[model samples]
Target chain A: MGKALAAAIGLASIAAAVTAPTAFGQPPPGAAACSGCHPASARVTSPVVRLAGLERDAIVRAMQGFRSGQRAGTVMDRIAKGFTDDEIQALAAWFAAQPKGGEEGNPARVPLPKGGEEGNPARVPLPKK
Target chain B: MTFTRRRFLGLAGCTALFPAPARGQGAGPRVVVVGGGFGGASCARALRQLDPRVSVTLVEASATFTACPFSNAVIGGLRELSAQQFTYARVAADGITLVPAMATAVDPAAKSVTLADGTRLPYDRLVLAPGIDIRWGALPGYDEAAAALMPHAWKAGEQTLLLRRQLEAMNDGGLVVIAAPANPFRCPPGPYERASLIAHYLKTKKPKSKLIVLDAKDAFSKQRLFQAAWAELYPGLLEWVPLSKGGAVTSVDAATRTLVTDFGKHQANVASVIPPQKAGRIAEAAGVTDRTGWCPIDPVTFESTLQRGIHVVGDAAIAGAMPKSAFAANSQAKSCAAAVVTLLAGGTPAAPKLINTCYSLVAPDYGISVAGVYAPSGGQLADVPGAGGVSPANAPRATRAAEAVLAEAWFHTITGEVFG
Candidate 1:
């Protein structure tokens, strides 16, 4: 179910990327509050997932689940219940507005040099052992 | 800088009396932050993230930030001290000026901070996140010299290493005692978690060993859940003595590893003496701390209620009901950053919703947690009704295991948010 939703969001994001150069308006001021847990848009290794470039509607729906206690969360349920509907909407729009892969304003998606010859010489893999 | 009386009139109540930067004379709002722990680092980064126009200078005494949240894991040998360590590289990379100096004094009226090296940093606003400093001499015989022998391990880094070393050196079937402090300490669940983790180490490594927790408080956060877990997972290995039962460690003789209480004295192969703490000395030096040894701040803006132009966050600030945890510090920092931005822009600060989630590992793969969402109510941060709770006591093992994963995840994510 999670994969299916991700695939659907992927398709929608591609379409939105092509049609609308921007996702929404300026990032919400309170959006930084979420940064304390979800650092940036980039995929983080921690269990607490990132929220940089998810679909606005999906983000809103997820927050609504947390708010209503329909979603099982370690901490988000309590945190979401504190926000008003409007604040959640603003948060969703702000996160969604960030460009996914690499964009000027998005701090999360700084591209890493692919490994092998393209990466730093110190980290370059040696010949096959 | 020019003393423009009229310009200061509009921001009378909020802004302190300082030479207002002449129009376009200076670049932007200059915010100077002290202490580079969760609170200071998060506030510095959030200020720049929220508003690029603001210039942030973070004054941290240490080069690397050692997180207290996961220090217990380090003590238990589950995690390395390196894992709990963080650098200011990310904050500096994010455009905040990282000042490696100890802040000695904060002059609110002049809006300047004096560092140890005699560097006076001027600021439009100052944010103080000086984490707790142990109130030496409060607990008789528990001083710096004693801490060297009976490590507190509360501040992380060297003390944590000292505790770990002591545990590793101790023999099997030995008695490990932890003297926990009274209420309003840095982390409410920390001492228990340390006891649990230490018990796990002793059980796995030294099966015959025993653990004792001598707590000053009668009860603790998540008492039922912790007690239940101990009975189930580490039965006969752990014991807890509350204050009513003569638990408080009134004094410590580090030379002999003996803790003296009103009832009697208890000796141990190894001991952890967590002394009472207060707001960092800088807060007191600045005259922000009151009789309670904590700085009072406006819940809405985190501006010092005792003095203007200075805001305190993290363990030092009296944040109403918020526990002094890394999560609370980071949350308060974000809100404080926003308030600084809004107030500097000549706008009224909006009410903020603060959140905190403190997770403790009872044993490896056994976790318990308490979460809360707070809002400004009657000039203090109050827990929103029906928005906070502790993990269920009788929950399934799977639930506890999942929470353990979340607990690990929370440590990494929060450290990244604050320092990364």
Candidate 2:
């Protein structure tokens, strides 16, 4: 094998070594509460739109859009589609209680609108394409 | 230029805030990092990036990292494996002594980690970011040999290739069965993406072929987005059997290449089973893992609560409120690296912030994702509420494809953070 290939293989074994037998930590207390409604942790924070200040009404609409093919992540969208209006609010309430994304957001850096502030209740009004 | 008294005072104030490792502590101390995937690589790279004086040794079992992040795209035919693969070339250039060895034993009390070849390396601190391993027998007849017959392809390398080959060679009307494992595995959206990609290929090449998903759970990550796209794009070509409908495969007889599920026995032209997983072996060997088969750590510093002088990240450590995704591993790894460096430097580690964004493609141009902000709290890191949520539903194809593009960029950004 070439030196590079040999080096690569060597690294793979070490990776295999570290991951010898573990998968992940146990789900937290509320994880089951969330999983019953959604499979994975649906609310993940990134440098994009903030999950804080999310309105239940808006969340429900978005979930409906996703479920109906007006949204994306077909899997998640469909799951959202199945939610009753009440469940959407529960999801919104659950995620809204979490903290804002740790990363700074520059919506203009890519696509979407400027994010909302902590108490400002910045609703991401559907983009006015 | 020589530092003036006034300038010296300004720099000194800053140093006091984030005190550098007391230099001439004789090349500081050595930090041995295991695993070259996102978590390990990020920790190793970050250690060197932040501290110029620390002597860092990174021992990895593989030379090339086939990232699970982009490997999904490769299976979708959007990219090749080479596009997702990386070498330690850049990390090695960063003044880190990259070792090609597997850590077989970790003597935390002695602060030394032993490799498979019996090479004992000592460290002031040891960082273990080992990923995961399949419970080979969790599903009956799913031993190492039998796995070859029905590839799990969970690791994102050869199995990915093998799974791809079988899919490519399958006939138009052939049946492709994807048996998804239970919760808490590597990459929540992974299995869904695999189904979507396979469907993409079938829709184009063999429109009549079937892509069937047998899921242990009724719901999966990004379910809405996946289903929406499937109905709109690959309708009648994809069928999902939930656990209630005998989706869970209890066992498989590789000799006959048949899968026996809770419902009944089924034969398919191709079968892929994602087995249940657990923390890597070394964590168990080091006594860091608990009875649950994963290492329990103080979520703040990601230090093993069960063992001193040892930190576990990635799929090995039980990190609450975070999906076992690549981004979470990288974030947790970076924070762990920071904390280890701080403690070794004789300073209190600062609060760490963990961030993650896991994107999944439902079809060739359709993608969705979930993002979150997390921080160590009390004794664990919990997800920030309303900070992030899954992708909106029924988005335009442009937006869906935009997610796919963004996922690739995020993959590049993270891998660069770890090993680039």
Candidate 3:
């Protein structure tokens, strides 16, 4: 039984290393922070728009707009001025490659436990006027 | 006690219930995370997500975590305590071992954590996200017992409800006093937000009551925005006393509900004295804390400067220029997780870029925020030039309402990420 357990553990480790999800590529330095406010999960309803699966050019254009004060945002303008053009390009490309469904996104989304909805106000839709 | 075929099958079935990939039950580097708040929980989950081969264990004292982000809303009667409460069922379901026991001691040399129940958890890396603990005797006449009479409500659970009940039970024309702490505390803008929400509660529920904020700092985060909203929404109801104006509370008399400042002593019907704070007790026990009572870390990796193999994140860490807010904590945790993964694989971790956005609601519909991008510089984290600042002063009402909605959204999205 002990030998069997050892073999199973060894096989699992090898499988994990071989199937590691680095195939999706690593995210840029500051890219993970964007999902703090922007919903990575389609299941999460928020006023902030999700950046996953956006056109790389579109994301770059919006960031440039915020940086140059051409676009108006409550917080994005301040945040955009922090990144260089190269960093922005890298982030845009990384986010654009993420799956829109959110499973294979920058900030990986996990399945909530049963009745976890009660703690997540974002899951509820905002009231319409 | 002999192993039978049926027994072997049952064992296999149990192992099948937890997939080996997610659980990292294979031979790999082990990580043990203490404290299940935004920092610790995010790190534990991020470690698993980053490399499923790494075994992760989260040791939290409580079954449920009460988040401090929206806890002020609870004190203002704008939210329920249940909305701020979350369980670790999802974190456990992700296959990390969840230990619901207080971590008592750390043997850094041995790389093991001793729990209150006498179980020792061995680990290759230890991440301490213990958050902040109130400095009990730092303020004269304010200790654990004094908290019963004059609640701080800083730590969020029972104290949050206590302060709310005090506000609810106060007389219609009563006075509410909030004593704000000095620099380098958890949530730089929290005291002001608490003051705003308490004023909102007073305006709607007890029209004749008044609130005064005794600030230990002359200026605070988003100061102009908060002051502007106070003038427009709560002109006569709320008053702010800056430190230069003798606003610093020197001591407290809980029984009499009196706050003594350098100028004079003021008695209030309800007193919320936010005392001095330091890193949580566990960090000190682990011998990672410095003279500042906070752990100093390598800004890029969050590895303790004083201790090897132990990383500190969240409010317990002295992250330069980054306010000790939940958003910053979560961001730091992710960076720490990434660095830990690389280090375990015998690779050098790259410099990390981090961000923090903190929203303060002046009213249920009026909100303001400060955002910043940060990177490692000069051996500490520094704000990226021209990248972050407070909300524009004198913005239109529509903008304020929009920010308020976004503030709620930020809360939901962040809490969902960390706890959901």
Q: Is candidate 1 or candidate 2 better by lDDT?
A: 1
lDDT of 1: 0.79
Interface RMSD of every predicted model, in angstroms: 13.7, 19.7, 14.4
Worst 10 residues of 1 chain A by lDDT: A120-129
State the C-alpha lDDT per candidate.
0.79, 0.68, 0.83
Residues B1-420, model 1: lDDT tens digits: 243534643564244223347424444778999989889988998888777877799999888777898789889988776667777887899899999999999777788999998899998888999999999999989898888888898898778877877787788888889999988899999999999999999999988989989989899998999999999989999999999999999998978789998889998888998889999999998888999899999987898888777899999999998999988999899889878877776665656667788999998899999988776666677776667788876889999999998887777677756665
Each candidate's clash count? 1, 76, 0
How does the DockQ of candidate 3 come out?
A: 0.19
Q: List model 1 lDDT by residue over A23-90, tens digit each.
A: 22223434656766675624344556578789999999998998898997767776777565666776
TM-score of chain B of 3: 0.94
Query: lDDT per residue, candidate 2, B29-123, as tens digits?
Result: 67888888878887786787656656789989887777787676666566666656777877887788899988899887677889898989887
Global local distance difference test of model 2: 0.68
**How do the predictions measure up, each by TM-score?**
0.85, 0.73, 0.87
Off by over 4 Å in 2: A1-129, B1-26
Question: Best to worst by lDDT, what's the order?
Answer: 3, 1, 2
* Model with the higher TM-score, candidate 1 or 2: 1
Question: What's the C-alpha lDDT at position B75 in model 2?
Answer: 63
Candidate scoring better on lDDT of 1 and 3: 3
Model 1, position A125: C-alpha lDDT score: 19
Which of the numbered candidates is closest to the native, going by highest lDDT?
3
**DockQ order of candidates, best first?**
3, 1, 2
**Model 3 pairs in collision:** none
TM-score of chain A of each: 0.53, 0.36, 0.59
